[model samples]
Target: MSRIQANLLLLVIALIWGSAFVAQSQGMADVGPMLFTGVRFLIGAAVVAPLAWREWKQLARQGKTPTATDARHIGGLGLLMLVGAALQQVGIISTSVTNAGFLTALYVPLVPVLSWLWLRQLPHWSVWPGALACLVGAFLLSGAHELNIGVGDLWVIASALPWAVHVLFVGRVADKLAAPFLVACGQFLVCGSLALVYSLFMEPVSLKGLIAAAGPIAYTGVLSVGVAFTAQVVAQRYAHAADAAIILSSETLFAAVFGYLMMGDRLNPAGFAGCALILGSMLVIQLLPLFRMGRHKPASVLDHPV
Candidate 1:
């Protein structure tokens, strides 16, 4: 797929995830965050297992075997997912949804920074301005009038590091893995298992709460985790992590739109401006590469269509 197509897939993921924010909020109302995360991701694991099995069988037919190194990479990805999700869930309980959403998007800028530090991949020139715009847009979309670093905000901020790492890891491993579905399944299983273990030991969990949050859990697990996350793993193979992160940051805008549609929450002028800025960032990021490539011959893989 082309970079543009990959970006479109990520945008769809943002939409699905954004709309599911309400379900996440409702799910947390009756259950501990850890327990809720465990159950929902377990559901996601179950939903994706068959697809992973099919991929495994195809690889087997092709005489390809997964190595221990592949297992280790998958495990690492899972651990990153677990850390980011746990922190976000805990932070969500202590912060407003708007705060959680906006703060989580700090990963947009963080992705490029992490990539530069770990992978020695400098972000495209466009990424700096695009990420900045997206961050500001996310803030406005969140409807926060003041910047306060609460415990929850701190947790969310910490979570962004793992999330940024996760995006880079996905981009790295997606090409190495035989099938992205298997990577998704493995990560979900690991993340879910970790959360389940933690919930059993530290959190109050009950079958009753699980049943109470069944609808939300199923929606998030099946659609958001299973489908959307798998799309991310597949798409990132074709897109720059920094660009993908900026695109996904538009989730806050989608969340605002969904909030208005589902809960009768109205967007103020700031929210509308936020929406415009995010869209503008996307356009800039998309077209800037093309313009630069036109002026000068392509110098790197990213300069060409995938």
Candidate 2:
């Protein structure tokens, strides 16, 4: 697929994820975060299982042998997914959809920073301006007027690291795997298994509660995890990781819109301003690369290696 097509797919993923915020928030009322995430991912795994199996079978027919390193990477992806999802689900319970969405977007900037720190690969100079904008926006969105941060917001912020790592890892692995669906399935399976273990030991899980939240669980599981995540894997194969991140980050915008329409969510003036800044940052990051590419002597590629 072309990069533009891949980005469009990422945008669709963002919309699905943004729409899922309400479902996830509502699901919390009837079940614990761990239980909800566990069940939701299990459904996601099941939804993708047929495709995953087909891919695996096709690979086997070609006499391809999976390596230990591949298994390790898949395992790591699942663990990262589990951590990121758990924190995000729990964080949403105490924060507004607006707050959660903006805060979660901190991952966009964090992605480049993590890349620099962990991989020793410096991001394009343009990243600084966008990252600065996002940082300021995050502070403002965290109730800068009141000079306080919500606990849930903190959790969401903490989750950003794992989310960034997950995206980077996915970018690294996207080209290495022949079966994106199979890899996605492995991730969902491991994530769901871990979440289930946590729910079983620490959270109270009831069939009645799961049934009560069936609509929400189904929405998040089937669309958000199953379809959106699979799309992400495929999109990343054709698009730059940074571009993919920026496109996926539109989830914040869609989440805010969906939250306002569905849940009567309203942010104060400062909060709105913060959201605007964050949106601006995303646009800046996306456009900077185009500008650089147009120059006679481009300084660096905006799409840095993952």
Candidate 3:
């Protein structure tokens, strides 16, 4: 797919995840974070399993089936997903969806930095300014000025690193595998299995709690995990990791909107300005590359894998 199409897919993923913040928060009313996370992802795995199997069969017919090494890499991605999801799920118990949304978005800035540090892949110059804008926007949008930092916020902040790594790693893997559904299914299975195992040992998982959280688990598992995350893996094959992060960071804005509509969350003038800044940053990053390409300049990080 074209880069623009990839970005559009990422945008839709952001919307799904944004709205899912409410489902996630409500799910904890009956279940522990680990249990909720585990059940939801297991549901996601089942949702995608058939598609993954079909993809695998097609690949086998072409003699391009995935290898054991691919399984290990995908497993590593699952571990990162679990850590990030667990931290966010736990953190959301004490934090408002607004705070959790923006705090989780801190990964937008971290992605480019981590890419540079770990992969020696420097993003386009525009990405630097765009990322800075996203950071400032996330801060203002989070309404942090009105509330003191709490333990939950700290956990959410800590989750950003693993999320950044997950984004970068997803980009690399998607580029190589060209099998987004299989990657999505494998990661979901791995994450779900590990989380369920952990929850069985540490948390009390009863049928009543599962029934109570069934609505949320179904919503999040089917839409957020199954659809949105699979779309992300597909989109990252064409979009740069840094650019994808910037685009996905718009989830904070969508979360704020959903929170206001569903949970009575409010935003001040500063919050609106923050929203504008994030939208502007996304536009700047996306548009700058087109202009650069017109000039026949060297391909930027946005146009190539990074």
Candidate 4:
């Protein structure tokens, strides 16, 4: 793809993902959070599996195909996403849509820190400051409420930490494997299976909720889980490691916008300030790469979805 085309693809994907904040916020009104997430992911897997099938067939014809290790790597990646996404969804149940949106976005900076701590390498200076800004935003946003740390908010923070790990894992996985196909297969199978299992155990979903929320459920299942996820897989291939992190962070802004438009939720002054700081921190990390002074990953060469 041309540079403009690649960047545009990533931008479009980011927009889809960012907009899903609305779908998720609306999804909880009709269904239990666990049930909603499980259902959406089940739909996600169904949509993505076919995309992977063609790639698998092409590789089979070539004979020299995916190694056993590659399958295991994919398994690990899928599992990471499965756990992180599940937690984030469940967390939203207790938290306000606004708080959840802001808190979960902390993963953008957490990625580099997690990488640094795991590898014994220092994160760039910007990583620490950005992470701090995220925490402050989280505190400001969540602190305004009763401050009764709900199960859902706790779940989201847990999700944020793991989501950071998932981001790092994506970089490695995209580098080692045929990115889009591997990502599609992993998300399809793992999240799909886990969602089904979780649905059976934690959330015996009622037919009424499903019927009442069909529009919302479908929006999330198809657009948020299926299309947005596909864009993430493809875009990650063409994004620098840090750029991928920054792009994904746009979900918060989109979330805020949707909240205002759909829910009549307007941020207070403090909230707006917090949001600005978080966004500014992310932009600095993404746009001022040299300021961070780290060895960033280059965009991967991968096939784009039509």
Candidate 5:
């Protein structure tokens, strides 16, 4: 797929994830965060496993089957995903969703910085301003006026680092493996199995609670984990990590829109402005590369993976 197509897929992933935020919030009512996360991803793994099998078969035919090193790297990616998701899930228990949203969005800027520091890949110049705009927009949209440092806030902040690393790692491994579905399946299995194992010892998990949370599990497992995350893995094969981060950060905007429509949440003037800034930033970043295409090439981790 082309870069533009990849970006559009990332945008769709954002929409699915944004809309599923409500289910995620409501899901914890019946079960512990780890249980909910574990079950949902296990379901996601089940959903994707067939496709991954097919992908593996295809790669094997081409003599490009995954190596032990590839399995180790994919497992690492899963561990990062687990850490980030677990932190955000646990943090949201003590903090307001508004704070979690804004704090988690920090990954937008973190992705490019980490990519530069680790991969020595400088982003297109437009990514800096675009990422800043996305961060400010997320803050405004979150309706957080003052900086309040709470324990939960710190957890969410901590989640952003792994999330940023996860994005970069996905881009690198996906590009090398050329097997997006396989990557998604491997990560899901690793993350889900580990989480479920931890939850078994740490949290109470009853069938009754699982049934109560079934609706959320089905929605998030099927859409958010199964489809959206797999799409992200595929999209990042062509899209730059920095650019994907900016686009995916718009999940906050979609979350607000979904909240307003479904939950009767109202957005004030600041929220509207935040929406505009986010949209503008996404457009600017996408367009800037095109404008410079004739003169200079945009630097991307996908183009020069370390």
Candidate 6:
């Protein structure tokens, strides 16, 4: 895809992801967090599996079969990614949409930290300020004035750790895998399988919850995981990974907008101020080098993490 096309696709992905926050928040009213995750992931897997299969067929038609070792490596990477998605879904339901959105976006900055720790890869120092800005944005966006981090907030934070790992690996898998579709398929299958096992062993899968949450669950599975995630996979193919991460991070903006427009959420003046700060912080991270130092190209390999 051209850069413009990639950007447009990524924008749509961000929008879907943002809107899915609304679904996740509402879905929690009717289902247990883990159960909701299981159902949503299963649905997402079902939707994406066919696309991946078709993609594989296309590769076969072109007489291009990946080596067995390559397939296995990609599958393993994908499985790890699925685990991250499932955790994020479960975590989102446990937390507020704003908190979930901002905390999740932290994975973008967290990517470099993890890379530094695991691979000894030193991202330029500029990423530090962006990391700080993301944290401040999280605090503001979560409205953490009360200083009482709830159970849900803790869950969201837990979700961030795996998210960071998944993102780092996504950058890896995207670079070598047979495009995004196969990677997405393998990832969702692992997630769905784990969710199914958890549902059977830990929680009772209630038909009542499924019946009640049908709409929200479907919305999340289809738009959030299916369409949005697919776009993320394909879009990252072209944009600088950092730029992609920055663009995808705009899901917070979409979530806030959808919250207000769809659910009649009202933001007080204080909330509005906090929102502005988060937006400014994200923009600064994206445009910092462009205006100031004129340092390096923003195209870090870690761009646009999950």
Q: TM-scores of all models?
A: 0.93, 0.89, 0.96, 0.82, 0.95, 0.83
Tens-digit lDDT track of model 6 for 1-306 = 665577678778888988988998888778776677767766777888888888788878888756686567666655665566656667765566776777677777777777778866665555666666655655665566657666766666666667666656664566565468777766666666777777778876678878999999999888787777766777767655544565676777677778778877656665676567656655665556555436554454434332
lDDT tens digits by residue: candidate 5, 148-195: 668988888899999999998897897888888999999999999999
Computed on alpha carbons, the lDDT of every model, listed in order, comes to: 0.82, 0.80, 0.90, 0.66, 0.87, 0.69
Rate residue 83 of model 5 by lDDT: 96
How do the candidates rank by lDDT, highest first? 3, 5, 1, 2, 6, 4
Tens-digit lDDT string for candidate 4 (1-306):
443454566556656665676677667778777677777777876777787777777778878477877777777777877787778877776666666776677787777666567744454455566666755654554344546767777888788877777666664565556647556656657766776677778776788888887877788778777877776666666554444565566566666667777877677777677667756766665555454346654333332221
After superposition, which runs of candidate 4 have C-alpha atoms over 4 Å from their true positions?
1-11, 120-125, 130-149, 290-306
Better structure of 2 and 4 per TM-score: 2
RMSD of 3: 1.7
Model 3, residue 174: distance off in Å is 1.9
Worst 10 residues of 3 by lDDT: 297-306
Q: Over all chains combined, what TM-score does candidate 6 have?
A: 0.83
Which portions of model 1 miss their true places by more than 4 Å?
A: 292-306
Every candidate's CA RMSD? 2.6, 2.8, 1.7, 4.4, 1.5, 3.6
Question: Residue pairs in steric clash, candidate 2?
Answer: none
- Strongest candidate by TM-score: 3
Name the runs in model 3 displaced over 4 angstroms.
Answer: 295-306
| Candidate 3 lDDT by residue in tens digits, 181-227 | 99999999999999999999999989999999999999999999988
Poorest lDDT segment (10 consecutive residues) of candidate 4: 297-306
Could you tell me how far off, in angstroms, the CA of residue 122 lies in candidate 3 after the best superposition?
A: 1.5
Worst 10 residues of 6 by lDDT: 297-306
Rank all candidate structures by their TM-score, best first, as comma-separated numbers.
3, 5, 1, 2, 6, 4
Measured on C-alpha atoms, candidate 2 has an lDDT of: 0.80
Per residue, candidate 1 scores C-alpha lDDT tens digits across 1-306 of 876788899999999978777777778878888887887788888888998999889988888767788889999999999999889888877776666778888999998888778767787788899999989988887776566668987887789998998987786675776488898999999999989999999987888888998888889889989899888888887788888898998888777777777756677888788889999998898788887765764222233221
**What stretches of model 6 exceed 4 Å from their correct place?**
3-5, 120-126, 262-265, 288-306
Each model's number of backbone clashes? Answer: 0, 0, 0, 1, 0, 4
